[model samples]
Target: MASGNVSSVTEFILLGLTEQPELQLPLFFIFLGVYVITMLGNLGLLILIGLNPHLHTPMYFFLFNLSFVDLCYSSAITPRMLISFVKENVISYGECMTQLYFFCFFVIDECYLLTAMAIDRYVAICKPLLYRVTMSNQMCFMLIMGTYMMGSSGAIAHTVCMLRLTFCDGNIIDHFMCDGPPLFQLSCTSTNVNKVVVFTIVGINVLVSSVTIFISYTSIISTILQISSTKGRSKAFSTCSFHIIAVSLFFGSAAFMYLKPSSTGSVNQDKVSTVFYTIMGPMMNPFIYSLRNKDVHVALHKALKKRMFF
Candidate 1:
């Protein structure tokens, strides 16, 4: 439909993680282990939260959503990556678009969701008396729904814009998956709309979410400082530390990757940055949340004890 000098690029060959034959087996097992851990940790968290009554709260509810996101996020890239390590890492145009769509959707959802979680924490810590009134079930549900809508909308915008471009040039996506930038690179057309959409979406999502986090943490820090007791401050800081770490890892990597000038950063550099959010962030999420959050630790302990006794 779209007019371009280049007409068709049916399938693409993915340049996987490595081409060094000697490193294949070791890398395969390492990723296999990472995937297994990601599945078990996230799945276990979800199940523990679902079964345990004590863990039924706004915090855990959002956490449950986060676990689900991490699970889907990892599945979107990791399984294919695993397979690629073993065999040919080739994907069709249709399949590549589908992967890009879902991957974009979940990744964007996480940005919004994490911002919402920060707001929730801000309410709980800074405005404890109004926590219930502020982060009510209805409100949480609405926030989650809004996040999903934003994610879907962004994904659709990117995917639709991508579809309009004629990929008549080259189809060699020089990375593990059909990432947004690499996909854009393969287009035979000018890709003006694609560039605009990418810039607008990335700018809006990152700017909005980052601003929300900054505001939330500002209030939170003020509240923490007002507490004269060192122990109290430490306790509050500890609770929020995990979230801050997660946010830093997720948003920092995203900002670095998406906010950079494409003309300045090479495609390979972009791909490397993408690996932080796509692979590293997901891998680190459960470890960060479970190990750092006291509530999750208690829930895990209680669940294990109950299972052993019963």
Candidate 2:
């Protein structure tokens, strides 16, 4: 029992986004504003989707999930960070793991959900009449459930692997939140197991989602080329462009931060790049989807009008 005792590290001091005292307040306000926008944007999108019956397709079903993910994702980190900026920047071990768990869950779920959304678009655009039949209510529900399960599996694997690693001395995490990469870096024990598990889980996530999006888009392009009307082609492209941009931002930054060995970059650089996916990506998601898509705009307007009249 004595030999197997895990060394206790109760609290971790976050090095935070920056070291400069002068920059701290400014950055705090900036991130605070970003968090506010993320919350409102995502919440607004959720309300819009739920209120408008017309937007109740598989596409908006996934978008609703995405809005939920964004809200949870931002809430997992931003509030704590705002507090830390004003005074203390410490997190208990249990709290850290909890944050890491949900953060991983939402983010990884987005990868799968986004892929599912792409496939939905592919079915809608390419298959047309078969869209309703192929992407039935049951099928959509199953897909959402499957995506959540996949996300939970990855988060559980990484967090469990992290639990095995001993953290004896240093308790500083050099990032805004409790993420896998930074947490793994602080372990006193050899992190080979954690690394292997993370790599395996993340690799499968990135690879499978990438391939799915690729196949979806490839077929989508083929379908578009067959359409003779320029207006029809443009409309189809517009509908997908927002999703493509969101995917590129989320996956591209995620790949850059996690796909490579940790030794290649400084902790500071790593923290900054992580901001893109963890923070900026969530902030941008609802904005990208809602602001750019006409259907979403229409839905938003109808919902607002009903609220105003009622």
Q: List the global CA lDDT of all models.
A: 0.86, 0.87
Tell me the deviation in Å of residue 238 in model 2: 0.4
lDDT (10s digit) by residue, model 2, range 204-307? 99999999999999999899988999999998998899999999998998888888877697888777778888889989999888776778878777767887
Residue lDDT tens for model 1, 1-310: 2445646877888877776788777878998898888888889889988988988889889889999998999899988777767888888889989999999999999999899889989998999999989889999999999999999999999898888887766767777888777778778788877888888998999999999999999999999999999999998998789999999989988988877887787766776678788877877887887786777788888878988999
- Estimate the TM-score for candidate 1: 0.95
What candidate 1 gets wrong by more than 4 Å, as runs, is: 1-6
